[model samples]
Target: MTYWSGFCSLQKEVQPIELTKRQEMILQIVKDEGPITGEQIAEKLNLTRATLRPDLAILTMSGFLDARPRVGYFYAGKSGNQLLGEHVRKLSVKDYKSVPVVVKEETSVYDAICTMFLEDVGTLFVVKEGGILIGVVSRKDLLKSSMGNQDLQTIPVGVIMTRMPNIVRCTLEDSLSEAAAKLIRYQVDALPVVKEAENGGGLEVVGRITKTTITRAFVELGEEATV
Candidate 1:
């Protein structure tokens, strides 16, 4: 039997699922450049062919893609474009919350905690003396720091913060889908939303992007694009 047949057999034995990130990425790749082989898709994404086979199987079974004996996978029809477009649209950042809660790097940990409590937020973006995003502090970070012998009054917010490279951020133009993908892919609670400063320097955060924001936006839009 063929790949499609194999996938169908599996689906009959189990319920279908919405496409996952890896699956969605595979579909986008195939839809953009098809008549392509599984090996090719795996190579492009730095995935092993064995790892990608399951995703290809699900896509073919769901009718979003078709595989021939040798021609590889092709978009089954117009639904492919519509689905891809919707995915692209949802990923855009313009549709979601853009206001960020920020604190200076030198702010006391005690004061930061108060800010978090008053604002009812779990994380605080740390900005530099010049207003550039430099790091982030989560409630857990504060709790850990506060639990120790270090004095909260004397400790700078930067002392307990997760520094740059550890922090995740996105631009105002990024798609909600992309943000969600990063959140899951990186296993993080929130992303700092930043914009390039007019002076052409570092990122200036305009908002705090969270998974909740993406979920709410997705629900409001009511569009599902193959994961």
Candidate 2:
């Protein structure tokens, strides 16, 4: 079956290509004398047309060179960073978000710590009955609460969690770049992904965006270039 793909598929099709020695020479030759045929380029390089075919194909496919019917190859004139930015901007938060680990506000700080360790997550979203977000608790928040003599089991997470209107969050529609910027600006490890609730209630937690998620996206981008 045929599956429809979005602009994100371009990430795989056009990567920040690393040109080889011969490929570099071919590109320079095209830049100097464009609208030149493959046969002509091969002649300039002192190689046969058959020998230069692979280099020519790589350049054309990577968007470094453009070819026309009988007109020959010309430079596409884009820098490496320009191409990288184009692919990265196409990624949306919805494509990379992970499932959220959440707890109710009434839960004790002790239980929250156990949940954080069990799930291997650094931040936990505190929600009401319908999964409506009310606050956010971090590893640091739990640690600070544990330091005091107050009974961890008795104190509710609501007492120490950073309540809403102050929590950093993103929505499914946000770009991955925007989410990354928030993480840096706030100096937080993760941002809860939220959306409007059906009954016009507060934002409801849907997913999460983290440093690891953005890192994985970039790593995939590099890997695709090699392939």
Candidate 3:
């Protein structure tokens, strides 16, 4: 994509990137040379291409340079901070929440464990017949239950899960920062993303936020910045 094309876009955003002096110099070199090859840039600066390859890679990946196969790299004229600020300040939970893993409130503890492992999730949201949020169960919750000889296959997860009116959750409107705090403040790894039920009933589980979700968001943001 062109450099100006990214100006109006957040590029999904990223944290401010700090550039070393040499990296800045390399960017300046590319700016002056215009659509120059990495070998030419390095040779012009009296350095081997191998010596400067990492800086070139960093510049291209962080939005300062654009590279094309066999065409070398060109200055993209984008700032790392400018690209990153948009995502952190403007993006909300709705963009990052993952599909929620849910099971019926009446589901057996054994079944919930199987579902958790099958879905590869850290936490499971227990819902009513209509997918209304009712409770939450984590790996720890299952482990505690499993440690005992209580009938896991017959015992309901609703009995061991953290019941509603107490579950830590976020709405679609909540910011990513707020979701991160909910994870930290509650000392939990995940939060059920919820929305208010019809009229004045209760929350309906919509999605989920987890450490993995945040990590994946940053990974994608970095990828977008590069593109």
Candidate 4:
């Protein structure tokens, strides 16, 4: 069952099938004495099994109860963390990736360096004219290229970038855990989030994901689980 999420007053509209006074009593009986049979619960309440059947069915369908053909009913609270883990796994790159900082592969090294500073990013995605990803440049790469008294304005960044076929990337459909693993395994400051090109045979850079983004996601997840 799904919830009607809200910040406050979950008492009323949270459950689609709201429990009645009798149903609440039945739930407590099941919690206190389960893997118990329906007949046992009815006997404890001094009611007939037919009269309590509907309430049992409602609670089970609403996810407050679970029934097995031979094992009877048991509380489902123990599986809450498992459900939360599923939510984390379902998060995708598109939900967390930030806007990409991009520069043309042919852009002057001086301009690319300025773009990096202006964008406040440790890395920059290098793209061709049609926004197709071709290479990547980092601050360390720029520093190394500048050490020989080179003409930054005359040289294009493409000459100093980590070229295609070596770039570590992830698509938007990829899960957050997959992206996180790539971030750790590759030891890159950031990843270019891309999608298949409309014309095929290349990828178009759409966004970027970094360590900070994943950390923030962890913080949010913790806060939400606690709440």
Q: Tens digit of lDDT per residue, candidate 3, span 38-149?
A: 8889888899999998998888888889875544577676444633553454458998888999998789999999999899998999998667988999999999999867
Best by lDDT: 2
Model 4 residue 145 lDDT score: 83
Q: Please provide, for model 4 over 1-227, each residue's C-alpha lDDT reduced to its tens digit, 9 standing for 90 to 100.
A: 34545434566656466579999998897776665679888999999999999999898888888765534666666465554455567678999999999988789989998998888999999998678999999989998888887899999998999998999999999988899999999988899999989999699999999998889888877775555
Q: Model 3: residues >4 Å from true position, as ranges?
A: 1-83
Q: After superposition, how far is residue 189 of candidate 2 from its true place, in Å?
A: 0.7
Give the alpha-carbon lDDT of every model: 0.79, 0.89, 0.83, 0.84
How well does candidate 4 match the true structure, expressed as C-alpha RMSD?
Answer: 14.8
User: Would you estimate the TM-scores of all the predictions?
Assistant: 0.59, 0.68, 0.62, 0.66
Clashes of each: 8, 0, 1, 0
For model 3, the run of ten residues with the poorest summed lDDT:
78-87
Which is the better candidate, 2 or 3, if ranked by lDDT?
2
lDDT of 3 at 152: 95
Output the worst ten-in-a-row residue range by lDDT, candidate 4: 1-10
**What's the lDDT for candidate 3?**
0.83
lDDT of 2 by residue, 1-227 (tens): 22446556866777688889999999998877675689999999999999999999989988889775544676788555654565577678999999999999989999999999999999999999789999999999999999958899999999999998999999999999999999999999999999999998989899999999999999987876665
> What is candidate 1's CA lDDT for residue 49?
93
Worst 10 residues of 2 by lDDT: 1-10
